[model samples]
Target: MAVPFSHRLDWSIATNRLAQALTLHRPQFDLTASNPTNAGIDYPAGLLNAFQDPRSLHYNPDPRGIESARAALNLGPHTLLAASTSEAYSWLFKLLCNPGDAILVPRPSYPLFEFLARLESVEVIQYSLRYAEGWWLDYDSLERQLTPNTRAILFVNPNNPTGNYLKIAELHRLAALCAGNNIALISDEVFADYPLTGDQTRATTLGDNGECLSFVLGGLSKTAGLPQMKAAWLTASGPGAGEAAKRLELIADTYLSVATPVQYALPTLLKHGAKIREQIQDRTRANLGTLQNSHLRPLRVEGGWYAIIPTPRTRGEEEWAIHLLENERTLTQPGYFYDFESDGWLVLSLLTPEADFAAGIAAIHRAFTA
Candidate 1:
């Protein structure tokens, strides 16, 4: 018998050149990757100790996850990470939003948003994050595009490549706008823990006074260097948002997307965040110094695991990256790959091994000079 698949799955394209390189030369300097595990950071043994808990085999499915795990999330690094099991998905028809519902996304941000939105059968409307004033959101275009069919705005705090965090004032204004419009806020804050300038205190949680409904997504992928664990969470926060959460819970319950062992081990894994975070921050700081020493003028990154260097316009970023790969055997992500607004940009991993990072920056300087 033959089976038919939904059109939404069509959005799932095999990754492009980046994936091809990894497949071709798996051992090359992986400056293009943001994954901490591959960056050579040491994972603490406690991570394994946490997962070895045999109780995970009991098969308890709460849909919203175990209460203990949820509590740990709430009390952990980010204040908005908390949630009551009952408040877990609130909208029953979130699945019903259909393929045409418009969602706003930022330009010069992570490229995965397009594929993810397509998989959900949702249409993406792009808004520019202009660099004229240090990469601020172009709220003008965003406000103009707010149509009746617009469902939500997708934002990445400490956005990838750009590495700019949403300011507190901007966050409040954004939340109020969404609340007023009765639209939802989908925030991807995976880089929240890596702030370079400020101490690692939780930013204002999305749930303050519950004025606007918000879903902040985070995971062990970046936080604890446990991406292989395949655990991530979507926290819904708003006053009286229980109904919306109930609906989300239904979708999660139907899919049971989170793994049993990982869900059970969440608390212990979350506790280990401090150790992993320390190492990553140190590596990032060292890499930042290397970037500075190269005199290549990297964009100011308040926080995040990657950096974007402004190259000369004469040598296009794609050609520059390709040439560096061939000549220096150094792999780097071209700005075009990440939807950068213009030419002359290259992205590199801050979490790359210190020695490799140092050598790569030197290679980059040579690429630029020669």
Candidate 2:
């Protein structure tokens, strides 16, 4: 018999076939590129020199990571380091859940949660983030999804494709709900630093959340535009935070997945990494301006590195994506990929080069007008 693989390993998708086939032949302007390293942003000189610290030659393992690195984060004494945010999620899942328990995630957010939950034998229930003039959490829908076995609620602050931050009022309400139900809050604030609009009401971070047991996640990925560094962290706060951190420390001890060198270099990386973050902020803002100036008026993006463009409903989102790829040689992601409830929406990466973003915008305009 063939090896009995978990159902989570099933990775077939038919929707991408057309885009893959066309890209094989065409030199396309890929507007879906979000990786800063792959994008054309210039890095600071000798940024890698930070990794050469002599302290890295010695090995002293701490489950919470090196004192200096954790101190550099300033997330407080309850912080723990992980290899990446994905690993952090896995660790959190393991810490909080038993097999078959459920967690509430936000709809129209990144689709990675389901897979991550499934891998841990946990279920994912989605709450709504409906969009009108801007994205707002549907609190009623969220409360209804809560079951006796609901262990946590995971939300991406300034969420992935939707690009809306949790408002101050919203955060307080969510904290109260989680506290009432005895559930934890996982706030993924990886994209918190990249703001495209002036939204003073947005909740910048959940590190200080004191209403419930909260875990705030951030990393060099978006902080410094250094995803390759493989250093991410989670800070536990609110009630039971000390015990939670102790349990999380046990989990981190099992893997020790974060490298010693990265931990040693973190302070330096964070210091020099400010320049890269500035560059990314500038690039995303400039590209967002390019989109707003075009015929297409993208949705109001309060922050983050993505913009949602509502295309004409003359065709389905998949058809529109394929049309753009086939006719315009411009690649974009249909909103359905991120679980947008309706059709006729496309998501573009604001990290795309300005010239390519403008050209892609023109191609999109031409496609609709023609």
TM-score of each: 0.88, 0.97
Off by over 4 Å in 1: 1-5, 9-28, 75-96, 199-210
All candidates: CA RMSD (Å) = 4.1, 1.3
Model 2 TM-score is 0.97
Model 2: residues with Cα > 4 Å off, grouped in runs: 11-15
> Per-residue lDDT for 1-370 in model 2, tens only?
9879887667666647556756464736888988999998788788888888998888889989999999999888899989899999999999999999999999999888988888888899999999889999999999999999999999899899999999999999999999999999999999988888876788888657779999999999889889999999999999999999999999999989999999998998999888898888888999988998999889988889999998888888888888888889888889988999888899999999888999999999999888
lDDT of each: 0.72, 0.90
Q: What RMSD value applies to candidate 2?
A: 1.3
lDDT of prediction 1:
0.72
